[model samples]
Target: MRRERVRRPSGAVPPSPFVRRGRPAGAQQDTEADPARAGTMGSKQIAQETFDEAVQENITEFEMEPEEAVREAVLQFESQGVDLSNIVKAVRPPASENGQRQKHQILLTLESLAGAVAERDAARLPQPLAALAAQCREQLALRCLAGRHGAYPAVLSACQLAAGDRQLLLQALAALAALLDGQPDLLDAAGRELLLRSLREQQDAEVTLAGIRCVRHACLKHEHNRQAFVQGGVLPVLTGAIARHGSAAELVRTAASALRVMTFDDDIRVPFGHAHDHAKMIVLENDGLRVLIEAAKAFTDNSAVLSELCATLSRLSVRNEFCQEIVDLGGLNFMVTLLADCMEHPDVVRQVLGAIRAVAGNDDVKDAIVEAGATELIVLAISHHLGQPQICEQGCAALCMLALRKPENCSVIMEGGGALAALQAMRAHPREVAVQKQACMLIRNLVSRSRELCGPILALGAEGLIAEARAAHRDCDDVARAALRDLGCKVELRELWTGQKGGLAQ
Candidate 1:
């Protein structure tokens, strides 16, 4: 079955694949001799207009052909020490019969190669297809246009027809990934099967990595494709990739990221998606939690891969049993050490904190996290990176989870100055609604079970901050009000209705 196309909202302009650099067309040019422009002129690259002007001069005055004139213009600019990296130094051919720019030569060549590969013998795949695939991999606009022109089946056909020729197979897979990057709906059933087959059967690390990349791009924002791959038993292949290639960091990282993307319900078109079910399958049926936790042992020194693994662990912790399972598998201790060791790396610390928070959904794991000395480390991480809003948000959230339902953990947070750190985060990131809300929620969780801690929290002017959050963000009203009420601050609790015999209480 074909995936349905998602339509953009009315009047919404599609994003251009090309990045326009340098001065815009018809903008006034600054001369190098201008006193104000001297310092900047040396760093500026040659604009397209200037390059075209020189080419015209070479053609008109020197009587050079267009192609030779273009070549001479490039040499002239290079001799003058002018950077020509951004200029498209080519002779502009006449427009086609339609009076528009011709289709990119690379895309035209890809189309031709697609037909040639399809018509050739199934046993002998042409080598030029691999060459064209390499070219398409470099240009995103060409990849996007190729997808629009129905290039997916041809590429998948090339991958299938490669017939164990590893290099050609790898290039074909890379081309498929580029085409599916933002155009995920182009991934049809045959493409999904090929992706799964490559990941499951291929023992080559490069081919496995390429197939994992294809899966990631295919599942990015397309819920339909995600479900299709999951139904095709991609979970086991993804987890097996890490186990099979344990020492390959790049392969493991890409596989972990692809697994995480399967649990994302980001596509608005598919409202009632199976993201939560997929997470459950990855953890419960496929033993994903244990696989990922064991994989973490190999990458203790690699902060980036560890961060991704931790993030995926958080995504897969969808149940109380999963949370407790992570702890039983020694995830909690590893996370605490990661937090303490990677204190200087904010990204790792943030994801580790998030994982801690997710697993802390289990009440016993909450106490375990605190006992591992994670509470103090979390507070210190927050204090160290007060300038980063994401760290502050995740740190506060982790503390909030640890303090939930366990008053003793609340005492630890207060002793570690968790309250003070959260309030400082709230104050530092006044414009960030997430920081404000999470800090407020932490306050309420801190003081919810222990009323006496409210005095110190209120003494830090939390009432004003919570009230400001309630006033500024509509979503924060209930939580902020609960915080205020628990802190012994007088807040207006409006009663919208009462149990009365009339039709409605107005």
Candidate 2:
């Protein structure tokens, strides 16, 4: 299966807690006093009527010009605690020439919101500011907002200041996550520190989930950020979240995905990456294997969370001992059972096969998996999902690993119709390079040790499929040819140049 990044749903912003309050008793009484001003107390009409009255008064009573009247009206509203931030205080321009003006207006609004967040003593965001922040759900808007001076720091400061209020804190963290989604460089030192602090200190599930998402986005494909986070002890925070919130499916899923991203070396800007080192750190220092395995027990029925946990386990199984550690912790049995139970879910089956394939890297684990009756289940899954190239590929690759060095396991695979399942996969996904290659390797490994099984496998039309794979994909050349040769079929073994003592071969 392809490793996909965990993404928030589109247009998903935190819920705003700042609702418009109803008119106060005094304002209602004022509205009641004048029937002409009815229902205008707390609506937009109130602001317009109030502004027009002030402007008219300024012109008639103070003998002010039109521009002076407008200025005086704005000042009067400001003095009366009316928010004119979103109001157009100048003369209206024609629509044809208003593009740049509209852009400037938007930037001004964003700046006002950011300034509100930056205030240290501000207890909570007002309705307009909170809603505006939530509107930054797209990349362009995020980039635009992030470009403004102090935008990132403002959101981070809001998170810090709103620590006492759960609703306000969630809004700020969600806004912060959106701001840092694809812009990893925007996470400066203070932003990074604030994110770590939030993850470490926050106990609310919603806040923790949002903070974990921020960590994932901040560290994705950014070598410097990944290393910094690891050094700052992010591994424990992630594992601890998993341990603490095993019942919270979304929390476990996001935290597991965050852990998986830490093992990625996908950044192109850096020549060499620390993916292997980070995986080792997660396994050795953080007890990741145990944590994840134990956490998986709580999510037996949740396919999405189980898929994430399984994929993460596959990523962390780098070393032989790590693979063995999974078995020692009873992870192998859990995966096998999960596969059998979730066979109907192609996604879960694919990830379980991958995790099993990863742990089968150890020789002993190979025998143990077979002993656990995985061979039959694997072939059954492959036969069940032949049309899904991901499932077929993972299944075939998994059987290939199980049959790598053990002839006894090869016998078991052949007995369970493993060869037939692989052939079906090859035929099902002819254009899929990974499926074709893995099937070819499975055929080669199956007959590599047991020559007697060659006739039965070749009888299932393995030769033509092998040759077809060899003809179709360049990557399947060696494996396909080896499978052909080992099945006692004639293959043209290419000899480019003879290693003659002289110089060249004609």
Give me the overall lDDT of model 1.
0.80
Off by over 4 Å in 1: 1-101, 115-142, 504-506
Best by lDDT: 1
lDDT of each: 0.80, 0.79
lDDT tens string, model 2, 1-506?
32332322324444222111221112211111211122233432223333444455455556667787678667655654554533335432213554442233334546776667656556546543465455555434334433444567667777777777778877777877776666677787787788888889988888999999889988987888899998888999999999988889999999999999999997777898888998999999989999999998888788899889999999999999999999999999989998999999999999999999999999999999999999999999999998999999999999999999889999999999999999999999999999999999999998888999999998999999999999999999999989999999999998877877697558
Q: What local lDDT does model 2 show for residue 235?
A: 93
Question: TM-score of each candidate?
Answer: 0.78, 0.76
Q: Once all C-alphas are superposed, what RMSD does model 2 give against the true structure?
A: 17.3
Which residue pairs in candidate 2 have backbone atoms (N, alpha carbon, C) closer than 3 angstroms, thus clashing? none
